[model samples]
Target chain A: MNSRREFLKLAMAGSTAAVAAPAAASAQAKPKRWGMLVDLRKCIGCQACTVACTIENDVPEGQHRTAVPVYELDGPNGPSQAVLPRLCNHCDEPPCIPVCPVNATFKTEEGAVVVDAEQCVACGYCVQACPYEARFINHKTGVADKCTFCVHRTSVGLLPACVETCVGNARVFGDLNDPESEIRKLMAQHETKGLRPEFKTGPNVYYIGLDDRLASTVAVGGGARDLRQGLETSAHGEV
Target chain B: MPAVDLMSFDHEAVWRPWAVAYFLLVGTGAGAALLLAYARLVRIAEAKGALIVAASFALASGLPLLADLHQPARFMHFYLGSAPGSIMWWGSWFLPLFIVSTLLLAFMTGRRGNAPMCGGERMLTMIVGALALCILGYTAGEMSVVAARPVWNTLGFPVVLILTALMSGAGATMIIDSLNGEKGEGRYMLVVTGAATLVAFGLWMLTDTNLSTLAADYAPVGLFGGFIIAGVVVPVVLAVSAKASLLLRGVSGALAVFGALAFRWSTFNGAQLMSKTETAFYGHEAALSQDALRTLAGSAGLLILSLIFVTLLINLLAVRASKQTQA
Candidate 1:
């Protein structure tokens, strides 16, 4: 039993090491981590970012290009809450990338999960593999899609749509590698959290002001109500 | 329903529909395959007819999955690899196997004096039967892996899917055989009904004990009301009362088809309803989010065109082949 336990631990550690080794080696070579930080305290859930994302990417109607999870928390006095905007956590160990049957979806050098629309066959395999429900098949393009952190914009040194149009200046986009970058600085100063850290997807998107209950709920079952809705609608009507 | 902000991410809602479609397609295909295998095993005269139906259903079920894809053309990539770790990945590998097995079974039985090589055929049927069970088991495992959907994350799902596949497939075969003027598929019917009852019972037990089991439970209502009563129960009762009545057999068979289809549809819909209701408090829209709707429309259009083309091609080929055979 002791030997078996030891073997299991070694196997687990070996696999973990194998997955992390690539990211760690890549991080060392680049010495820069690409990430997004959202300040929940400042966000008003105006949804400008969502709109901008759809417009910029020409995302189809009915499928979300990005999703901002809104939480109505019980405040100190009355029922007050905050909206926690989420997209592809763009995990350091992205569950969606390697599971792609055709390598249509992949991670870029800058650590963003990118989908080549042309290469995508619209199989929902990656969508299912994703723990965050971040990936969706874009109807028009016939490709799996999620927040790329606006790879197209970022290439030209522009901020992501969510970050660019934040009325409350809640969302921040920057290289996590640079110590002086806004996102890096925020991480250093604040006690921010990622959604479902226990799953260890190593999400790059970090959040501030996420309640413990909400986080735990997401972590344990990955948005159960949302899963239920998708299943119900697809049965009676067209998916 | 109020239009919740489309941008809000509710994980359950987003994943639910895709899962339902996946489950339905997998269930339908496996069920059809198993029925075909059972028909072959029992040496049913119209076993070839059942095989054709199974293959056609399996092929048809691939349609919804295309719509589910973000890039429908890229679906071939799944076939390019041999990834054993993923149920979806491995499930895909079974498609061609099923196709080949069905084609072989059809070819062997379609002609009057040419049955599948006796011993070889039996072995093939057994192999395909085992594979069909594997596919069904994988379908259940696929859902169970979600972990987040407490109802889906269990062992009962795999068993239910396997048994449901057998019941549905056997039920379909009995009906088709009766339609083709073959009688006395009673033993197969009994086996199917027995299997279905056990599966239904297991499903009920799971739902009764677990609050999280709502996702699967909602399906049986449709199954019993739409399929079981209309398709299996009434006909089965009639057939039981009167032996060797082609009329009774035909009715039961028809009911079985209806029940199987209804079961697939309900199971797909019920899971989605559970996910939607459970997550409504999160403020995400229950309707198709913008991106998903557009994808669906695009996939639908493509699938419609493809089906038209495929049907025309198949019809033309069939005409030519029949003429050659006659000559």
Candidate 2:
């Protein structure tokens, strides 16, 4: 009976310390810089990540938090398909954050951009301001919603649903701040490029083997003919 | 880089027709208030009639804006909890102050030539005029500061909006003066306003290369052509005509009003259609939903009702003042 009582007291004290440790450490430790890296070479155009994100986030039908836009480029060999996975770049210089009238959308201390639904006015200004076209108004909530990089799971040390469920292991998510992290290792080893780098948003999301046609979205210093040269023929296709 | 077929998803257009209508009415209302204040300050003979119309429009501008909010009941939050960096927060403050000041000015002047021009009245009128210009400028700034829409991302937007407001204001004044048979300095204002709009258009062409092309392609050739022909050419011709009839002056004024409305409609609607993504042009068909139509009609009805109420109130006030003097 005495041992049982001692065990209960120790358990209570241990639980209390466990809760207090993070709060104490958070004040001293630099916030984790979370990011993602996608290998287009390995992506099979299956859209499993898209479906997994939708299911995990409870994303409304006809809306997506992430999308994989497959581009069939006519190469010298033949028509080669390159599936480009797109999501909120979580930009360091997010244009959407400043234009928001209420500051409903903001970047987290952990470097994940998130929306405060209670504060959102549903003005749709943020929807227009995102260069990546990453945001959408949630019809169900009547507020703006977008990819949060699964902060709920990431905060508690779990992989994002898309990364967990990726069939080809193409999606990689980790702390960019951690030198030994897989994302940092891959980034150091490979020449990865961001989508629309000319915008200079410093997008955290990086891509390996991204097509040139897809990168020409923010064409700068091009003449009229040069600008019109590599236009996307599928303007009407579904995103 | 080889040409590729890029599939893009359509984004939710947060600002709908109600928002467009709000911008239109607010811009016109502010414009009208400026004209009325100027006329009153200069002691123009037709200021009384113009004041009634301007005051009515100013009071009615709030309806569409209130309706545009998803939570009308929560509008108090805008005042209570506002971000300092946001232009919208400033707009929330500016719009209400402008409306209240204009309303007071109209009331003070509504005694219909019986009320002597007090120093307080002149001060109020000047304040209203200043506020009206601010409101007009802020509306354009609200759109132009948005970096995503390259069409609106220019300093030229506010200038164009202000010039358009002047044209609309001058057009309203000319219509009121012509109808009441008390034309005074209205024609001069119209000429100046037309020239200013032309200058603004030239500046807009120089500032936004992509939008200028889109504006040329999408902005109605007939309406713009008609605006120049009916609003500018015919008005100039009538002003200098040997025998200028009120009928001809009224027609020109009416066309100017239509042209102002067309400019707002095309700019608001066309900006949304341009593809923000490099994929392709996002096809934006106007929302003709039943609820949307009803809300639009309801907004117009509210404006007309306000006009009628103000007119009645003016006549009643004038009668009351005359009776008191007689007694």
Candidate 3:
């Protein structure tokens, strides 16, 4: 009984310290910067990541959780193509978060923008607010749903469904805060670009070998289009 | 005409007509309800007429929305969950509340005996007022969410919707009050009508100056041209002036209704034109590319003609109904 009391006392002290230490340390710790890097040069458009993502998440048909927009570029000699795997950019300054009247959607400390499915009323407002078409109404739940970046898998130290199944090993994921991480190393080595950077969404996903010329082809306020020369150059260079 | 691309024929792509119809109907309903609620609060004699108009508007708004639904049978799904995050969800809940409260207020007032309003009755009326404001605000927010379309993506949208509803409601009350031979209702009508017009004009001018292209798409020829002058400025001027007779009041009320409908229609048309133009002119062409201009002209023509026809029909019916009620 004495030993039990001592154990209980130690456990209480441990719990109090655990709560207090984080509160103190959080003030000192720099905000964690999270990001993703895609090596487009290595991406073969095999679509292994796309299928894997759907199966793992049970994404609905006709509405994709993630989409690979295939841009066909006409060239001097022949037709070439470049594929951009479009998903939630998980923007640093998320537009969708502020518009939710009920605070059903919000950003996490890890910088992932998540929606509370229970709180969502399935108004389709967030779907329209997303400039990149990242969100879609889950037909089953009748609520706004999108890529969670495999939060469940990532928490368990497992790769995202997409990253795990990427055939070309094009997608690299890691804690961007860790200097030793592969993502950090690759980002350090390469100049990266993001879609609609002018919107200043501060997207975490970065692309290497992003055809700047092709990106420029997207007219201001106009939606997507195909660029012939840029795609040919990118495809030829990659092969 | 450009060869019609049948493969990409999106039923969802044709959003303007539906959006305009929805906005106009909802605006009218919200406006009529506010007028009735205010009349009841103030213990006005024309409260019964206003209540009837409010109920009519609410019922009219529901028709278009029901028609717009792909699966009308599943309409009850909106009420199944208290989805506060969605404007439509909140609107669905609030609209019914407003309708029920308005019915109860109408019932209480209809009783011939001199019975004082119960505490529950007063509380319910207050709740209806608050709910009506919410519905107005939510409708505006719903429109503003279409960020890709610059015309609909303004901070002014929700505020404009509220003001428009108030103006529409006030205009509706004036017409009903005049026909019913209520004394001094015309002055109240004139004041609200003038204020509503000024607010509508001020908001349009502010929006025009800030977003020039959006203004061009909406008011095209100038402020004096298109629906603004015909629907808002003219009606307001007529309603305010001393020469404004009962005939003039009827004309002004008709104009106000027309203006509200036209404004909504123009907004819907402008958004569609802007998107189509942007899609056609992308990177390779000038901002005002020939193809973009053509699309704009075609869309504007279609929208304006449709408005004229619909307005004429609604006004003819309304005038006839007012005459019969008076007789």
Candidate 4:
């Protein structure tokens, strides 16, 4: 009888804790939905953001957490260099999430996609499933790594390393949920675009002055791709 | 084109040769298990080779799969967390159960006397057969759902994968029978499945919108030269023409399995070599690392060791039965 009474009291306490948890959560300000906006017009192609990201994330050599791909378009006024700074889109319908066999990768409450190194089995299934080619197996960590939107700094009321170091003020990082945030205001003022709209990934990262011609079809041959291929081929004794 | 890339790095391949080995071994084992089920139902003593191949290959398939992962030791994460949504996670559960069922069936087959199989043994074969199909389905399904890869996501891809597995499985059965100094009926099985595999490939190349667009340029030499000519055409021709020679039959068996491996290499590696963002192919060459070589050797060694175990077990059962008869 005494045991049963104690059990009932414990069950009541547990239910009360569950009920109180959400109430406590609601009392605090709602979590921020972080997103990035890149204004191509402002970008001077200095690659300062890329350098800062590499140093900040400790990404190994010959790999990138973020990089700008420059394309030379054959315009009516002759050829011109165009820059498109690329990183993880942190898609609302992220393909990388469900494909993780261990549930090691997930969208944070603040809307950043992140990988838990400890839980990752490094099967590379998620890497294969990612449409953006954003994720990779980090050689040093031996786990899937991608741009986490620099969550460690963002959570502590600081800007991401890339955004902080951006020379042209091109990369904008802010809370999408907050109405008065700079990203939201910028998004409202301009006709924004996202890469690979055909994929319907619903990318949170918006861009201003994104060239429509550079959407999908890029001409074959020549680039860092060829240079990297030569290095890789030589390394593997294919040369 | 309106634009030329001044600078961009091509995406690198994540799945390697070890993944291909795992798929090949498991598919062969699953196919052999299906054949073993048919043989058990009909009491075809000639298909004893199928039973051995099914158990041994299934047992040997897991190592390469684990080795494919960067964190081979961390596979327990698959079961430690619940992930019903992931096909690979579902495979983690299905694979071990399939292996156990195949092994259990082999054990039961050994213990059963020369008298026809009882109801219990017949039921066991059905269970093993069901699990074998699940393994095949899960493996193919896991690859199919990745819509990111245009070549892999096609409806025809799974059909080709399944047909080739069946073809390889039939070939392995013929190999075991030929080695056992017998003319088995697996030649006809090989012919039909091998032909079906070619038909599936042709259909895939012709029908799949993405593959049809890319097939002319993207299909590497391995598919046409290695898989179709050497793997299917040569072995299939031998299987059809040389009906009496057991040595020729064994040769066909080896070639069929090799063809299946070639198909996987051609498709898995070939599709990955294509740049998702561009029209060009990535420069990828298989570098046989020490780790990959060790895994390959380990799988072969494990198969031979498993074969010895099964041989001794059946022989022991036969000896015990003879002693009981004398008593």
Highest TM-score, which number? Answer: 4
Off by over 4 Å in 2: A1-28, A216-239, B42-46, B111-113, B184-186, B216-244, B286-296
Runs in model 4 deviating more than 4 A are: A1-30, A227-239, B42-46, B209-219, B287-295
**Model 3 steric clash pairs:** B31-B169
Distance from true position, residue B94, model 1, in Å?
Answer: 2.2
Query: Model 3 TM-score?
Result: 0.60
Listed in order, the DockQ scores are 0.15, 0.25, 0.07, 0.34
Report fnat for all candidates as fractions from 0 to 1.
0.20, 0.30, 0.06, 0.64
Arranged by DockQ, best first: 4, 2, 1, 3
Instruction: Give the alpha carbon lDDT tens digit for every residue of B146-255 in model 4.
Output: 87788899888898888788778878878988989977656777898889888888888777766754444545456777788888988899999878999999999889
Per-prediction TM-score: 0.71, 0.85, 0.60, 0.89
Top candidate by DockQ: 4
lDDT of 3 by residue, B1-327 (tens): 121111111111233244456566567657766665676677544454455555555545654555444334556666664556556667777767765666555554444223455677666666666767777877887767666555566766555556666666666656665675543243365356546556755675665543454454333432334446776677778777735477677677667766676566555544443322112211122224464355435434543453344334344555665566666
Write down the lDDT that model 4 would get.
0.79
Ten residues in a row with the worst lDDT in model 3 chain B?
Answer: B3-12
Candidate 1 DockQ, CA atoms: 0.15
Q: Which CAPRI quality tier does the interface of model 3 achieve?
A: incorrect
DockQ value of candidate 4: 0.34
